[model samples]
Target: MTTTATAAPGAHLPEHLDFLWRSPEPEKAYDVVIVGGGGHGLATAHYLARNHGITNVAVLEKGWLAGGNMARNTTLIRSNYLWDESAGIYEHALKLWEGLEEDLGYPILFSQRGVLNLAHTEQDVRDSVRRVEANKLNGIDAEWLGPDEVAKVCPIVNVSSDIRYPVQGATYQPRAGIAKHDYVAWGFARRADEAGIDLIQHCEVTGFHVGGRDGDSVTTVRTTRGDIACGTLALCAAGHSSTLLDQLGIAAPLQSHPLQALVSELLEPVHPTIVMSNAVHVYVSQAHKGELVMGAGVDSYVGYGQRGAFHVIERQMAAAVELFPVFARAHLLRSWAGVVDVTPDASPIVGRTPYDNVFLNCGWGTGGFKATPGLGWAFADTVAHGRPHPLIAPFGLDRFVTGALVDEHGAAAVAH
Candidate 1:
């Protein structure tokens, strides 16, 4: 197989030359203006148009659509979380994914093959147990698996009695699998376009014409190309949401982290499910095209840079070879990186902003790909009704200020 330096899963597109340099000439007022045309933004437009009859919307992308973290992900989808509220919401997302193809009239390649979080130590086993218990409370199918059971699920994994980062056990959920990331975005984009939503590409949001916190809430937004008078605004701009928030004088409780992902040439189908290992700091799975997708920890510092040094790549290789010995001979195909918008506690903030017409759907840290539908669905609900969804209310920006974060460090350490 081969690898390529493709654009990030989701990114902002520039506006057309006719729009203006950095601000459009207040063309038209949209019922809702979604910043960042990633999966979240596209899904939001689809739901608003498809479900709520709010078709007078505009999806503003600073770059090509879905050019950010949405396309950089390794496509691991699972709802096995450690917080009842979070687990509940993610489970809701899982349900939406189950019917995504029929809902969008397009294929998402949603597979229920399952995801395995390998436990390399006693604490890993304990954490798996805790996640299982927590997820069970929210009606998730998270099962604790011992070494033998792990082998039963994926015999290719060296879950034997002796090994580096020996397999003590694992956390397995049957309902998690992979999907084509770009396809998901295109599917939603097609539906949203069909519903009469203007996909204004190449539009950079430089600032907003904030008319105070009272009525006329955020009347217009000044973009790199032109100004758009949007009735409501939803920020789904991963890695760039904070900048957009700052433009509106909104201080978000989020940190930006750059994550790297690599893919190999198409090989024989050896991996069916996603496998995550914290002890090795690497999670890998084979894509439908048969390329082994590999990802590991992030850099020590946080920045918007999307390149890495040999040091990081070397460490990733060591972990991959240790886990799958055959990979030792595999040639290096391609490597790429993305700037992920992370929260202090590593959980996503997906609900409302202080401004009445502004909503937030970012801070996904390491797992935004799986929550694309959930974030869009909940965020759209917030924008449409001018109130936060019960599931997303707890994840408001106030959580960090109020010290009410749902700290799921266990999952964040590896899987996220």
Candidate 2:
């Protein structure tokens, strides 16, 4: 493990991050095997070593580390959901995000610039206010701000009544903000690597060998690199989770969709706070580098493609211009997409699978990046004890059949 100097507060990030984690060859077997090297998997591995003292672990990534959704997300972090179950997990993650920099001994560039989920219609106002009350009951900081107050938070937004979807109000979370996605991934990777965990790249898991008496447990994971035996297997593959679950003959109701996001050319910082409008179907925030980081709902169609349809981008920009009139002249820099695994209720599925010693952590959709630290903490405990953590117990696979789903479609504010 190498020790890199932490940047001063509000200082510019290094042009190039020094090699923080070692690239080690995958061993034939390990105590725990995580199938994705994204933020979630890396965080889980870090907590597995830090909390449980479990160091013999391997994180298998088909591509480069954090090159997947970890790099493609819009980088918004908030926990103002409308349900108790949703609030529990997300708020926990927000608390973890508040202290992540010092905990990782790395500069994550986490900014608590606050977030405002705008309401454009009467119904939007009703829903936003209701969610604000729910967040308050959950002990989360939330406030319902009128259009004028919304303007005070973000002056550039087009809040006049003349617009098609005029701002009625918004739900504001003062603690919510964004972080540097790449830095968050690298921070977790460095810590996990320091704990003697093997972070293996270009190692794709192709199949699974279930060899218990009743064929109820996975004994070995067959990867592109080679087969590796494991005592416990955890799937944190995000959009590609179904591909690996298919090898184990598990039928999970997961749909993979292309979630697109784009950034504008670097300019003077005009946006002061993060603004999101589910009615307009777009969200925008100013990054540390002065780029306007923006994104919208996922593509309607299901596919594994990393790039999204042009129509989605066109609609996203149209929505952005309508919400923020000043953004009309902003030059489009570049765009990219990530495959997100969505569930029927727009909530994640975490906990034990039908197979013994096999854990599942997917279906996070667009909210995965925000839930990195909290999910990692809970999932690591789940894997260590071979049981569902209380925080994630409500999101088990049985919810679909038992009619106990944590439906977040309407409350999620965005098509997660």
lDDT of 1 by residue, 1-416 (tens): 11112344454444442221122232568878988888989988988876688988888877777777777778888888887667867788888999998998888888888988888777777777988887777788888888888888987787656776888888899998889998898888888887878877766777888785464478997877777888888888888777777777778876776788888887998876778888888888888888899888777787777776678878888888887887777777898888887777778888777787788888887788888787778877778898888878888888888888877664533436
TM-scores, all models, native as reference: 0.92, 0.95
lDDT (tens digit, per residue) of candidate 2 on 1-416:
11111212333223364468788888999999999999999999999999999999999987778878998898899898888998899999999999999999999999999999988778888888888888999999999999899999999989899888889988899999999999999999999999999999877777888889998889998887889999999999999888777777789999998899999999898999999988788999999999999899888998887886788899999999999888899999999888899999999999989999899999999999999999999999999998998999999999999999888985645533
Best by lDDT: 2
lDDT of 2: 0.89
Worst 10 residues of 1 by lDDT: 17-26
| Runs with alpha carbons beyond 4 Å of true place in candidate 1 | 1-26, 212-216, 410-415
Error of 1 at 64 (Å): 0.5
Instruction: Determine which window of 10 residues in candidate 2 has minimal summed lDDT.
Output: 1-10
- Model 1 gets an lDDT of 0.79
List runs of model 2 lying over 4 Å from the truth: 1-18
lDDT for 375 (candidate 2): 98
Assess each prediction's global lDDT (C-alpha) against the native: 0.79, 0.89
Best by TM-score: 2
Deviation from native of the Cα of residue 390 in model 1, angstroms: 1.1
